[model samples]
Target: MTLEARLAALAAAGQTITYGKLARDLGLRMEELTNALERLMEEDAAAGRPFRAAVLRQRLSPEGLPAPGFFLKAAILGRPAQDPLAFTRAERHALLPFPNIPG
Candidate 1:
């Protein structure tokens, strides 16, 4: 499956994945994953969809939040993210209403 489809499935299931594991599963370098996610974020923004890339967290992220690059991409896409945790939570929630989950 494509990365977007995979991410959408994870979002629908209210699940999150670490960036490292996702990268390995997709046979991608970290940079490649980040670039792809940024493009996805841009498309999501244009399409008025929730940021599916928000489901990608850092391995060491205690709250299951995506890496800083996610936020940067969001900002570049004209999404204001003054609060990273809330922003990601809301995006994930939009995809699937798991309000208590962080990812």
Candidate 2:
């Protein structure tokens, strides 16, 4: 399957993946994978669509402590959208820090 198809399939299967794992699976160097992902993001942005890949973050520790550093839990293609505000809200939320989270 093509790289994008493989990524979509993994997402459909509800499998969480990271850049390292994806690179290994696709037989690409880490830099190559990064470039590919960036290209996808750029294309989506240019098309005025939601990012093709979603980045999920999670605490490193079970106690939800921030000391261990956050990690990328998943990267998946976004679903078709009928509402543009949904994407705007998500982007706004991500860029603007909330009161609870430290900047």
The 10-residue segment with the lowest total lDDT in model 1? 94-103
**Which candidate leads the pack in TM-score?**
1
lDDT of 1 at 46: 99
Over 3-78, each residue of candidate 1 has an lDDT whose tens digit, in order, gives 8878978988989999988888889898898889888888899999889999989889899899988888888889
User: Candidate 2 versus the native: TM-score?
Assistant: 0.50
* Residue pairs in candidate 2 whose N, alpha carbon or C atoms collide under 3 angstroms: none
Candidate 1 lDDT score at position 41: 86
Instruction: Assess candidate 1 and give its lDDT.
Output: 0.88
Candidate 1, superposed: residue stretches over 4 Å from native = 97-103
Worst ten-residue run, lDDT, model 2?
65-74
Please write out the lDDT profile of model 2 over residues 7-30, one tens digit for every residue. Answer: 556444534356566677889896
Which number leads on lDDT?
1
- Compared with the true structure, all predictions reach lDDT values of 0.88, 0.46
